[model samples]
Structures are given as structure tokens and as C-alpha cells.
Target: MQDWAGVFIPLVLFILLSPGLLFQIPGKCRIIEFGNFHTSAISIIVHAILFFSLAAIFLVAIGVQMNLGP
Candidate 1:
């Protein structure tokens, strides 16, 4: 139902972003030897943005749903 859309959007977004969040692990291991910190820094920023954007979108959706009532 429409209620489910509220839950599904964030779930789908999170699932899609999960791969990007994990993509730098091997690169991180290799980069450690070279003392290169940029890989991890970029990964952190990407993940933080992904997570916060999803959270903000979900919050806004929920707020609108609440304002509209059940």
C-alpha cells in the first residue's frame, strides 16, 4: 500500500548505496602500505553523504506522511 512506499524508498536507496560504501575496502588495504589516506577519506565522505541523504529523505517523507495523517 502507500504506507509501504515510505519504508521501501529508503530501503532501496540503502541497498543501492551499500556497494559504494564497501567498494574501497581492498583499495584501503593496499593504500595503507603506500601511506595514502585519500581513498579512505573519499570513502568516508561518500558513505556519510549517502547515509545522511537517505536519513533526511526518510525523515521528510515521514514528516509529510504524519502531517497528512493515516
Candidate 2:
């Protein structure tokens, strides 16, 4: 159960963040395609950093809790 909690914590955070939903936007817009999908230029860097940093933080918290044990 504790191990499951560790796994679910990050999963829950990711679901709440809904980062995958970003991909659902239509690709027709030049900014969407060029800014996010095509390259990691200045335009999309902030968003990319935010998503990964949040994900890493959540996962690390889960890992720490798991290591501490019940």
C-alpha cells in the first residue's frame, strides 16, 4: 500500500497538471507548431521548464515519502 501511494502521488500530480492536454491544441496555428512542437526556442522554454520542474518535484516528493516508509 505504501509503495502504491508513492506511485500514485506523482501520477495524481501529473493528472492534475494535465500537461498532456497541451498536445490537444490544434496544430494549425504557426505559433503552436513552431513555438512548442518544432523547436525548443525561447518562446517555449518557460513552459517547458515549468512542466518538467513541476513533474520532477512531485515525483521526488513521492520518492522521499516512499523511502521514509509508513
**Each model's TM-score?**
0.38, 0.31
TM-score of model 2 vs. true structure: 0.31
User: What is the C-alpha lDDT profile of model 2 across 1-70, one tens digit per residue?
Assistant: 3445456665765554342244412234543442233323443454456556876775665344554455
lDDT of 2: 0.48
Off by over 4 Å in 2: 19-48, 61-63, 67-70
Query: Roughly what TM-score does model 1 have, to 2 decimal places?
Result: 0.38
Write down the lDDT of every candidate, Cα atoms only. 0.54, 0.48
Task: For residues 1-70, write the lDDT of model 1, one tens digit per residue.
Answer: 2545466666766665553333443355553223233355566666568766876767675553423335
After aligning candidate 1 to the native by TM-score, how far in Å is the CA of 14 from where it should be?
Answer: 1.0
RMSD of each: 8.2, 7.0
| TM-score winner | 1
